[model samples]
Target: MEKAAEFYTLEKGILALKDQIDALAETDDLDKKDRIAALRSEIEKEWARIVPQLTTVNIVQIARHPKRPYTLDYIAFLFQDFMEMHGDRRFADDPAIVAGLAFYKGRTVAVIGHQKGRTTRARIDRNFGQANPEGYRKALRVMLEAEKFGFPVITLIDTPGAYPGIGAEERGQAEAIAFNLKTISILKTPIINVVIGEGGSGGGLGIGFGDQTLMLEHSFYSVISPEGCAAILWKDQNAFEQAAENLGIRAATLLGFGIVDKIIPEPPGGAHIDPEQTFKNVDKHLYQALKKFEGKPVDELLDERYKKIRKLGVFEER
Candidate 1:
């Protein structure tokens, strides 16, 4: 994981000011109290000026911040009565991908997401949010069950990529992801996908197909992570900044491409800075998205989904 200091070098001065504000908050001196207020105003002004000009690589860093909320964090804040389901039946349960049923605003829905655990040991256990074939299979099982009960499926996409270990390939990782793409494309139940963080490669796309796709303002979705792309294309991982810009992985860029149905604004400085507000923003958009498919006919929903998928990458040669 990249150090917060390294990735946030651009905000070094701002962070130092924040540290001063934190110190002032603990004191009861009148002068310190006034200083706190002044610092806050300065911070806000700085954020307004800096956030608008953040480069694509800067946004990528924010998206992958270790402190940023993950799939389980959002579930805790946004859902109720979450009963986690485990295993693919054919193999062991993979901790990297979580799948289950939950109550969203009193409505039952299936939830699936990539889980990159917080602690070092946990991250290793979760394979750094890289799923194997079994993990994808587990997700498919829950999604299919959602369809059986006519419940909507909500998937959170945040992964660097699928596990590329030989064992995963032997178990058919590529085939598992392919199966999910085919099944989700025509599933009878409504589907909503949210890119809360690093939506990278086929790992993100394994459960990414849906009627509506939403992305957090500072998050990124790409065919490959910038570092991986840089290594492959430029033969230098240090060229990630250029790769990020060329990939057009930002939420605003994807929104322009019609790949993202909506961009849920994050709090200033990114989601980790104010996760509660970020959760609320995501909740409001999710509710609105669900309402759009509330009473639509199955045939119409399927037709629209097919058209939407087909419309991607359409271009004309002059």
Candidate 2:
């Protein structure tokens, strides 16, 4: 197996901080300001220490962080009252892919995204943030509604990939994924997508189709993951470090390559380390992207999307 990249996770920092904080608390003679300052300084130091070294593999871990924000978490924090809309209108509701109409940035916007769970039981419950065929269908269903109603769409991409089970395939996984790209091609309302975590494969693309796309600094977007890529190319999963570097999945590389339109700077370490600060940065980027697309024509939006995607790879002379 590929070595888990060496990096401090948010949980680790939090746990370490807790120990120090508890020890400080037990010392009743300490001044309140001194204790608080010491705790904050420790966190800031750790956050600064780890920011520069976050790799694609380390991002994978953070994207799957048990406490990292999810679709519902953001909805609760960022939106007004949210009314969840469920079902693909054919099968059943999919918790893995949640959709809803919410009031955001002073207007109604449709939001959808993959939600990883905090525990093993919850991961199984949400299918490890991997959507099924029906999940994609449900997202498109909500997006189309947003289009018809002229509500802007906001999609948070956090899926490792769409489900690859027999049922998902039988339900037309490839077709469902294609249908998303096709439907969003002509959407009149603006679409904003953010790769908050692992934007893996078609599942990521299912909601990744948008007029403007932004990604977190530590987020990753790739056609396939490092492990899968390593397994395929070198037939050795242990080559993950090489696989991650070669995949060019980091936001900086992806933006340089034109695969992503904008990159939102994350909090010092990662989203998990300072969730509030991460969301703050994300909020700023969201409004900036949304305002820029506010008055653009559908034709221009399509052209921009096509141009951005078409020029995604290198085109130098051999």
Candidate 3:
């Protein structure tokens, strides 16, 4: 995990100012008020200049920040009565993937996501959030059940990639992910997918097929990681910073490609800076997105989904 000081070098001075602000908040000094106001103005000016000009690599750093809210965090903040389900019926469960039924705004919904842990022990247990074939299968199982119960499906995508170990291949990893894509496309219930962090390769997409796809401001979705792309194309992993720019992995870039429907704004510095506000922003968008399908018939919903999928990557032949 990259430290904030290391990854956000450009913001080091700003961060120092924030530390002073933190100190000020703890004191009952009337003398500090004017100084705090001036410090805040300086910080605001720096932010206004830097936030919009963040480099692609800066975005990659923010998306992978250790302090950023993960899928389970969002579940706790944005939903209620979450009853977690475990295991893929055909095999053992994978801790990297989480699926369950939850209540959102008084409506029952099925929530599934890639879960990377905060602590070392938990991260190892979750395999660093890299799902195996069984994880995807378990997600599909819960999704299928959600369809039966007429519940909307919400997927939070954040993965480096699917597990590529020999054991995973032996268990039909490719087949499992492909199966999810097919079934999710045709699922009769409303599905909304949010790319909350590193959406890398098929690991992200296996549970990412949704009628309405959203991405967080600093998050990215790509066919491969920048480091992987650099290694394959340039034979040097050091070229990842350049690779990130070439890959066009930003939320705004993907939105222009018609790959994602909405870009949910994060806190000014990043989601990790103010997670509660980010949760509120995400919750607002989720409710609005689900409401769009409230009265649509199953056939109409499926038809529209088909058309949306078909239109993706449609290009003019010159």
Error of 3 at 33 (Å): 9.6
Quote model 3's TM-score.
0.93
Candidate 1 wrongly placed segments (more than 4 Å): 1-4, 13-41
How should the candidates be ordered by TM-score, best one leading? 3, 1, 2
| Runs of candidate 2 exceeding 4 Å displacement | 1-15, 18-38, 316-318
In the range 1-318, model 2's lDDT, one tens digit per residue, is 123324443347755775676677777764956885788787778777766666667877776665677777777878887899989998877788889899986899898888888788998999998888888889989998998898889999998889889988888989988998888777778899999888998889988967778998878898898888999998998887788888878888877876788998876556766677778888889989989887688788778867666666666897
lDDT of 3 by residue, 54-86 (tens): 889888888888889999999999999999999
Question: In model 3, where do residues sit more than 4 Å from their true spots?
Answer: 1-6, 20-43
Clashes of each: 0, 0, 0
Candidate models: Cα lDDT each: 0.91, 0.81, 0.91
TM-score of 1: 0.92
| Per-model TM-score on C-alpha atoms | 0.92, 0.89, 0.93
